[model samples]
Target: MPRPTIEDVAARAGVSRALVSLVLRGSPKVSAGRRAAVLRAAEELGYSPHLMARSLASRTSHVLGVMVSDLHNPFWAEVVDGLDAGARSAGFELVINTGGRSPARERQALTGLLSFRPAGVALLGPVLPASAFTGASAHTPVVLVSRSSRVSTVDTVNDDGRAGSAMAVDHLVSLGHREIAHIDGGNGSQSAPRRTGYVTAMRRHGLTPRVVRGEYTEAAGAAAVRALLSPAPPTAVLAANDLNAVGAISALEEAGLSVPGDVSVVGYDNTWLAALRHVSLTTIDQPRAEMGRLAAEALVHRVRGERVTPARHLLPPRLVVRATTAAPRAMSGL
Candidate 1:
């Protein structure tokens, strides 16, 4: 059987093949009614896209594929919003996928995206190795978010994790917290920088630093808190991220402890969950959406042949004080 083509759909919809092409590419030039007709005709005809031929003809791929490490973390949603908006404004469409935060799975997801021959790819908080990213960049323009790269071929946008972690420690210190513990973002993107920053800040403050290993999930955070019940728990904890921090809260409550009274907590990313009226988690805001927007802009610059030197953007993070942080009870008198 002959496969349906764009011409078939165009004929069925009573529109030009060019109009069908515009509709298939999600071009803004197509009228609403015509777009609906073209889509409906294509659906009825089961016409699959000729992405390869279209890509080769124009030498302008309108598709941008994005791979997010984890969708469970609300932070990625905001970042994706910025990327989507930026891509659309610059005349590109985005399709996104997630690996749920596994390096192997991330590599697979990245490979699948690259196979589509997108104009470029945006990797948000990927856990894949540097070599993997570099290899992919060689095939297509690659912009990495929340990961650093020495290769000038790959552009990167990241919040300075070291500074952000240090800022969290400083906030705790200012609140008179000396026995603070850190829930490390184990093996996650930029986790090492944060862990190192925590250690450095503790040494600078003349205080002992303790680390709890956990992944970037609420369950891991809760488990870490449960494991900290012995050996005299620290007065407070700085969690890896907002999702993890919320899990820590649940665990702390389960352990018969009141937050900000018995154990203060701080989270990272400052995602929407942290800002909720109920969560009100003190956290480090990483300008996540801005990072995504900047990443898109950087990738577009390459696609447009504007910048040859890789764009490396390092944005600062800020500490947001919320209901979760308070002066240590021991020093309320001071």
Candidate 2:
């Protein structure tokens, strides 16, 4: 089939080709009625602007590259939706790729995004070191979501991990759980703050801390539970995230232990997976969509040369209690 062109759109909208061009470029001079007519005509004729051609003519791009840490997680998916909305509203589009939680793969992903020469870039929960981010920011504006940065060139949007973890610990402690265990997000982005918060809250409550080495995955959660079972199992556990929490629950059930009844579990990140009736996980809500929007807005500000200092957005997280957490039962091994 022949592709629709700008001329076709102009003809359909009863406007000149020059008017269509102005509309496509989002010129403020275009009248509201004419712009609407051009847009409606383009939609009906399936006419799309050639991004490369537009970039060559204007010497600028409307593309924002995004690198996601883990595509398999639903949390990142929800965050991307917000970025998409914000970017589109600002006359820009997103090009996204994933790193699968590997430092090597993440470096490759960032390189691929830079190759496109996007207007700006957003990295969601990157596991790469500060050096990698610094290198990337040297080329173009960079925004970090769900991660922190000391680099003056890069902006960051993150939830308060310490406060979130502390909230989980306080909830468990309130439920009469003194022997609560923590399954940490080993080597993952934002893991340190959570661990620190958990430990700090435990000490503040005068309870001994029992932390298990784990990563941000279900397999890690299950393995941590298995390892914790032998040497004085805790009555309640605070998992790294919702996915990890679900995995821990599965392992506990397979070992003939009941959730909340035998061992209460709490998770972080109130993703859709956490809110499922079958899961009903008690977790900390990170406001994923809001975070994404803030990240995109910051990137756009830098792209437009409207901001000089990097933005540091630290959003507060709140605890969402659910069926997964309860008052501790009599401590016992499975």
The model with the greatest lDDT is 2
Candidate 1: TM-score? 0.88
Each candidate's root-mean-square deviation in Å? 4.0, 3.2
Q: All candidates' lDDT scores?
A: 0.91, 0.92
lDDT of 2 by residue, 226-323 (tens): 98898667889999998899999999999898998988999999999999999999999999988888889999999999998989999999999999
Query: Model 1: how large is the Cα RMSD against the reference?
Result: 4.0
- Best by the TM-score measure: 2
| Model 2, residue 323: C-alpha shift (Å) | 0.6
